[model samples]
Target: MYTISDYLLDLLNYLNVKDVLGVPGDYNLSFLDHITRRSDMKWRGNMNELNAAYMADGYARQNGMAVLVTTFGVGELSAVNGLSGSQAEKVPVLEIVGTPTLAAQYDQKLIHHSLGDGNFEHFQNVHKELGFKVEAITKDDAISEINQVVKYVYENKQPGYLALPVDLTEMPVNPIFKQLIPSLFRNKNEPHDHLQNIEAISNQLKNSHHPILIIGEDVQRFHLQDVVRNFIINNDIPFADMIESKGIIDETLPQFIGTYNGSLSKDLTNQLINKSDLILLLGAILTDANTGGFTQSFNSQNTIDINAKRINFYSKIINYNEQNGFVNLIKIISQTSLSQSFPKGPHDSINNKLPVPSDKPITQDFYTSAMSNFIQSDDTVIAEQGTSLFALEQIKFPANVKFICQPLWSSIGFSFPATLGSQLANPKRRNVLSIGEGSLLMTIQEMGFAVKYDLKPIIFVIDNHGYSVERVIHGMHEPYNDVPALNYSLIPEAFGAKKNQYNYFDVRTEKELLMAMKSIENNSSQLSIVRVSMAASDAPEDLKEFGKIIAKQNKG
Candidate 1:
């Protein structure tokens, strides 16, 4: 009695998905029963579709891939922004959209979740436009379509869409298709001219005096951190990570330089990067944010850009069809004899000193420095796009710390929900969420989800009164940048967290902030929210400069 719903669940379960994230609607109610009944997978319903999608994105970042379920039309539309961010950041997320029944669609009936004009395909078309590998499933093609969509999303590391009709949930699948097999089409052979490209890259590395490796998010996505680290250590080459790829490799490594933003980078990092004779960009994408608004200056001829599908050495391009091309390249390069001597840049030793308790209010600089001291190794740190992210740029993370943020997408309200997913994916590690008041307000409902799941996360609500990121970009004094004031400390209790389950602190000064941190450390089993107040004009120096560049770009 294996049904279509069972087949999908089994496949996802085989992929190691322990939870399915979504917001239930009438169209998806029948399928939700299957998820609820399954002992291997639990249905984690979010307050809305957007947060569910964000949670899926975060889960995929930590757990390799994630599944997002939503109802058609309105529900799917609400999740589009989060899916787009996943697509932009190249995270693997499979979106299952429960649509109107096949009979209603065949008869062209106007449904509640469909367009008023009786067009059921409209929403599926929308997802396709956003680069999702979309397919509307029918009874006849359910198994094949499901497998195809999942395989595509898993292989490409991008979002995929499946429009599942409500009627198909209980349909019995053929006995022959009951045994779901892994994709047989995966090509494990080396790409064309793989050795040639590897040799060319090796020759370049061997001849160059000072070659630096610029690691990026793709390294983490492809699970090449160990091989990349081996290459770095074996060659004695200095390396720096981009914002999107921060903490992919251990930042505490002595050979690890600093974060390499274009002009906003530290003086030593900028100098070392600029002086390099050859730059090996392994799995690194040069997005505007990663390159400090595209201000990075390096000689094109001396750079070798290696990504998943293509290898660009100087201007000569070699396209590879295999997905493991990047993996193979790094592995072979790690084995090559290309040792080079380079001076290690001055590493920022982790400062463990707590701020001396004072009546003085905490400033942005003071808070950022303190946070650098507070974060421990192996903790997952999720920062919002605004002040939280900019402040994080100053901190040198401890070894094995997983840093999560939407730097490439620059979306506000993403971190809060993302923290929930990351924590659920790896419940053993402590999750720290640093978000501005403005960003948190957008997805504040997710706090209830965290409480309902009994997860313990230390949340820092940086209350600067309003949208400080927008103020620095433009309209420093404009009313449009202001957000409605809310008492953030009362949110956890309102979200159904009992007194014993959580702790809340309102800290305005350095002394108060330190006290709140100490209390949270003592009660590590309970959820803690520390709301720190700061001036609206105060921000990290890097953020102020980056904002001005963005403002200029927007004006043009």
Candidate 2:
């Protein structure tokens, strides 16, 4: 007989979820068994629940939607931070939590993973606070609830939580439920005022002399990059991308000016955006990091903000019922005669010239320039927050390269496990992970999972002593900023990687770092870790300024 577990897995399979990611807990074992029995879905176990959640977040960023399974209470709580990050970034991840039997929960029986108080709903409530559409699945409502929750997560691009009782996995389900649910795509019915709003926007674009288009993370989340690119090319409109949405469109396009980070943006980019008579913000969230600590200053009177559910034309708001409303609106706008001429010529792209190697110790500026030269087209770069992210901001990515980071959540250790999940999502692309030493220490065990799967990702461990970002903010010489040094060269072997499976390098000077990068380029098939040592005091200039702003804000 088909079980609820089977039905759920089948539905997820319809959404292109080929691999299920989680850590096995006692409560989740049976569900995991069901996952393993299916040929369409493979179970990829992680080192811990938090890492699993992070992996799911990364997988969702690449794979449209992701499913993460964890046990009730302890396991789910451990994964909460990662889920919060996904929620803040508007990523679609469905978290399935296996709880104690229905009978036990109803009787208030104290379970192993539950709080001693016997309240099973506490954890689900916590997820509710994090903005997940939560539900408790029962035999009567399992089919409908699963479909609703999954659809909500996918269409809204937000996290969803489902509590699955341990005994419910074995419950028999009707054969009729075995058929996949209908596709979640909604029928495109134009709103009544869509034509008027589209025409108004077109007129504004045509009348303006200086117009700028800014795309954000939501465009990538909603799979509208191609449509946005087409609009840019069709209109000959100059465009800038937010830091959070970097690499969503090809950066090499001459129409592409540069990344706009509020006041932190390049001088030319900032000047053009500030001077624009009309600004079109497509799916941009305008978060603190995206706006350079809330420094972006565009008048609503001169801006048209397009979001998933609604559109703000100048100061007026228009809501649409179609799920693909944003897509339709952009297409309609693109087809109209929006611009008679290009507003401005594109600024020159960054010069990614490779630095000459010398006997000098490697600095942040030199490292950023070298890395810019090292990154090729189609590589997926996972940059951890702090130094790694700041340095990556200076690099110019080639076409089709995907850049993944958690700037909104700003979680330190997220990129390591995320690298693994991103690689699993699209194994064809080369995954390069750049993480600081302090961040690596939090989720270093995930390296074992990488070795277990025999996945090859170039890992760069920046050994800048410790929490350099924090140091630059307030405590430059405080003991709290320091982290213990590790023998990074031996990490692979300790994580069960054979010599053939990986390569390890320890470099302090410019020549050694260059040699290690060259060697990894030559042998790109195996996993390689390069631990480059730098002075603890060295940091990117932008990071230092950002830290000052944060420090002032914190004091206030």
**Structure candidate 1, residue pairs in collision:** none
For model 2, residues 175-272, the per-residue Cα lDDT tens digits are: 77655465445454656448878888888888989898898888888888888888788878888887778889888887788888777777788888
* C-alpha local distance difference test of each model: 0.87, 0.86
Q: Candidate 1 lDDT, tens digit per residue, 1-556?
A: 8898988888888778899999999888999999999888999999999999999999999898899899989999999999999998999999999988888888998778677787788888888898999987886787889888987887778899988888988989865554635443355776545888888889988898888889988899878899888877777788999887888888888888888889988888888888898999998888888788899878577899998768888978888766666777788887877755776678553345655668998998789878988899999999998889888885789999998989888789999999999999989999999999999999999989999999898999999888998999998889999999998768888999898998889999998998888888877999988899999898888899999999999988
TM-score of each: 0.97, 0.96
**Candidate 2 wrong stretches, greater than 4 Å:** 183-193, 346-350
Show where candidate 1 strays beyond 4 Å: 175-178, 182-187, 190-192, 348-357
